[model samples]
Target: MSGNQGSFSLFQEILADQTQEINDLRQYITNQEQQLNTMKERLMRIRIAVLMNESVLRPFFRVPPRQRDPSYYPVIDMDLEAIEWMQANNIGGQQNAIRRFEAIYGMNLRKCKILVRTAPEEIVEAMNQRAELHYSPCYRRSLRDNSKIKRMKLICSEIIKLWEDCQSAAYPSDQIMVKRSNLERLLNEFWDGQGKKTEWFGKRKVNLSGNKVV
Candidate 1:
């Protein structure tokens, strides 16, 4: 009976040790997640500040393209001079234009349009820099491993759409608070699921009839 009690005590000690270890691991994971969230929030604040001050930063950093190089493509025809130059130098039609631009910039037409329209000069400089970055074999090899870029772009686009929708929604002033809250909830839920619950290129059905539930 003493031996049986001794065995039981040993088992309890071992179980206690394992439980303590598990608790320690959980604490470590929680700390890491907290650190990541803090970093993300800091980065987001910096991003917003930079965006707010982009116009001021542009003069020093962005030299607008005075001439359209043959390698370049204009996402929009807003600038008549740029459009005329692009047309004069364009060897092929619309598809070729988009293909050549994507080949150099590593982004699609829609993304190009978004950036260019928002900050034409800066985007032009960025595309030129990105093109140069890809010139080296080492850089090219590294870029091939960058799977997150497209996923980030898709998520950003969706978030932007939600924000824009919230802005444009015809909600009354009293209901604006509720509308914004709903938009935030939708943004968080969908953004969290992106690349985890759903693949970047996964097909989703859309209700074009404007009858779908929100």
Candidate 2:
């Protein structure tokens, strides 16, 4: 009887030790996961900062005329130039113009289509005038810079708000993740809409003509 009791006591000690070790391992894994998430958040912030800086600085770094390559033409807010090119070449109809713009600029077909469809009539008229007067590349560069800076600032502010909301919400991890995914999708849609609006105003010759869109 005495030997049996001793054996049972020894087994309980072993089981207790195993349970504590398992808990310790779980704690270690949780700590590692938290650290990994922190690192990822930091990396995302850094990437956004780099992109914003690039957008701001890009207009200043004009390629020398001799070194300029057709493939390196700036991609953002070139709708006015594209339309002028289309008109000059006798490209008829908005759809045809959009397709030609996509092919010439190597831009996404959907984005090209959106910009063409959404451009205000006033802006198109201004582009026509600019084309007639032979606007300088400097004018185009200024337009692109302003559009890019405005979009970047808007996106950055929205993303900051999203982060703040996520951090302040008292939600479980899974719920927070779902919210983040949804926010990202909404952000992309907002970006697309903003691009179209920016193209509308950015391509407008109003700054030079001193006219405002009604």
Candidate 3:
């Protein structure tokens, strides 16, 4: 082939290879999505089974308080030791451990909660006590127990179901909208149907204003 022909041939070969690579990537993503869906379904089924078991045990298990929503906040004194154990095991970093503690607390794990930044100077010696160190983590604790977690799960699961149904009904073609709605649903679940609950998902005017992600 002439030099000009050779160059054109090379460019065409490059394009063909790139197209094949793109096709392969697309197929990989499709397989991954299928796997993810399957896992979620399995997890949901397991959750349902657990809930059924809990229902069977309801008579023996202590009935939760009316005011107690099964959601309890984390208490530093109780949860911190576990957090430090998780951190030391490298399950997560310090910040991740802290954030998880915060999230668990938010999930309604405790009635009263407080997060300690560091041991106060007056309590520094007390904090270093071997017994205290054994019981408490560098930073983590739940003020509540698993007894109330059941109600919290029910509340969250209900909100998630409602959010899913809303998305399927209103925006089947666009799921970015669904995510926004889910955030709002979570807020409403937390706020118990307040007007401001609608604004629970921080305003994404860019998307809600009609700009679709796709």
Best by lDDT: 2
lDDT of 1 by residue, 1-214 (tens): 9999999999999999999999999999999999997865554333222222333323322232232122222123222223233456562343544454465456666766665655424234434434433332222333433443333333333434443355456523334334334433443343344324434312222221121122
Sorting all predicted structures by lDDT, with the top scorer first, yields 2, 1, 3
TM-score of each prediction: 0.31, 0.28, 0.28
Off by over 4 Å in 1: 55-214
Question: Tens-digit lDDT track for model 3 on 21-57?
Answer: 9999999999999999786555433322222232322
Relative to the true structure, candidate 1 reaches a TM of 0.31
The parts of candidate 3 lying over 4 Å away from their true place are 55-214
Q: Give all candidates' CA lDDT scores.
A: 0.42, 0.43, 0.38
Per-residue lDDT of candidate 2, residues 123-147 (tens digit): 2332233231222243334453555
Best-performing candidate as measured by TM-score? 1
**TM-score for candidate 2, residues paired by index:** 0.28
User: On a 0 to 100 scale, what is the lDDT of residue 139 in model 3?
Assistant: 12
Candidate 2: give its CA RMSD in angstroms.
Answer: 22.5
Ranking by TM-score: 1, 2, 3
Model 2 alpha-carbon miss at residue 106, Å: 7.3
